[model samples]
Target: MAQKGLCWKEDEMGELVHTGTSSPDISVIRSLAMKHLPGSYDTMDVAFFAEGSFNKLYCVSSPHLPQDYLIRVALPVDPFFNRESEVATLAYIRKYTSIPVPKVLAFCSSSESELGFEWILMEKIGGVPLSDIWDEMPVEAKESLPTEICGYLKSHQDLQFIKIGSLYFSLVRERVGTRDFGETSAYPSLPIVVLSHLHINS
Candidate 1:
């Protein structure tokens, strides 16, 4: 779906700065679908699915594909690093645990493409948001929810790593700097402080 306004953010100085690209070129997005996803398509259905502080999402469906996909375009607050780290985090989680995160189909970490934004095309996880259904749940279901959530948290705790830092692809971390920020030999990592400050300041 087409969005009419630019994505904006307030900076440290309290000035409003435009942080994201507006409505992206649908034709280019469709071409990306054809290249990375299964089947062929002259066109696909795209509709605005949601928007958050950091990204805008679109649902894409095609006659040739088996299922719908979601496209998440970042608002460029931290540019490449934000998108790169998130993709890496998902990959690391899937590799180490059984959490059912959306599978990444394709992504561009740079905003140099025809779309002028970093986007990830991923398997659409279908369910109404938890907020929408929480009040209607049975008492037993509600009681069990925290246990389920804690299970996921425990899974994360079970993952062992050598460094306290943000995860990144091995190559991406190497390209980020030569000095050892954390460790990049096994799973790439950048010091957690860097990521923390980026988020705090952004």
Candidate 2:
């Protein structure tokens, strides 16, 4: 028989153990699998692959299908944290470019029922994540990645104002300002180069 979702392991003091999957609030894995997926997978089992501060990622498979897809369950971190916007952004990117993003299968925003969290079902991309590849990838591949990313940006250069938000730069500014003072601080600078190229191309 297939294994069910993991249960919280507790300590002798009756407090929850610090497992990677343990969260302070709740787990929406089962609700997401049952509600968002196709009718065929309504009764299928789900296994949690990972969880982030903002979302829980799971791999779901059934006897009917040979493969599994990823489900991203958005945790309500704040009122302004919109899972719908993230889904829409993914959909918009997929519609405009062939840069290969996860294909959005379904998205739900209502938070009224058993599925208390907003979620998105997306086609899983196969490959080692970029983090895993960092140490293994060749220098040439590393160099080419930036070029490929730049080409992707260039492809969407002609996008209308409505398609891409107007305050995109401001978003970048905010991210830069709020970023940690460590290695991650460099991320905010990449937008400057990309924006400069975009301006020239437009």
Candidate 3:
């Protein structure tokens, strides 16, 4: 196989950086970019707007493509948080719900030959993230937000068994030293607050 000008290097921290970019363990991203966007190579533009501990995200754009996209680089410490399971669960959720979610364009796993980090490529959504706009909204808008969130939750309530296990439980276990307690009995009732409108319409 010919080298597609895609290779891994090291950042200042000595971590693997994919595509010669000064990012940590971007091998997975390099592979996906090379595969889906071969010969359309452009620079990776880092987004400083993120506020998370687990992933380094970038808003990637190219002159050849019409729209921008997001590339999420999974941290090496993510396995403890069940990264694969979360991705699988997201995939499962995407199958049944019409609620807006970033489309999973591609996923790549880490290996010695490639950047030693996992990453995912997703289509960027058009609107602002809830975190960015939530504080500026009116109280009425805030009230409606919960209803929308609950509607989304209710739609997936029937998907009792996600193909991947519970990420929340995994966090509880790692942080609080607890075991998986299975699904809570109260989960079904929680959605009623939002779904009450649906019941009235029916």
Candidate 3 at residue 187, lDDT?
Answer: 46
Candidate 2 error regions (>4 Å): 1-43, 78-81, 131-143, 156-202
**Candidates' lDDT values, in order?**
0.73, 0.54, 0.54
Local accuracy of candidate 1 as per-residue lDDT tens digits, 81-180: 7788788788777776768899999999887777777899999977788899988999999999899989989988887655455666656644444234
Whole-model lDDT for model 2 versus the true structure? 0.54
Write one digit per residue (lDDT tens) for candidate 3, span 118-182.
66677778886789988899999999988998999888776554233343422233342334444
TM-score of decoy 3: 0.53
Clashes of 2: 0
lDDT of 2 by residue, 101-168 (tens): 89887766544435555667787787777997799989999999999989888867744432222222
Clashes per candidate (backbone, < 3 Å)? 0, 0, 1
Stretches of model 1 off by over 4 angstroms after superposition: 1-21, 181-202
* Clashing residue pairs in candidate 3 (N, C-alpha, C atoms within 3 angstroms): 16-25
Q: Which candidate leads the pack in TM-score?
A: 1
Which whole-number lDDT from 0 to 100 does residue 21 have in model 2? 34
Q: What is the C-alpha RMSD of each candidate to the true structure, in Å?
A: 5.5, 12.8, 13.4
Clashing pairs for model 2 are none
Models 1 onward score TM values of 0.76, 0.55, 0.53
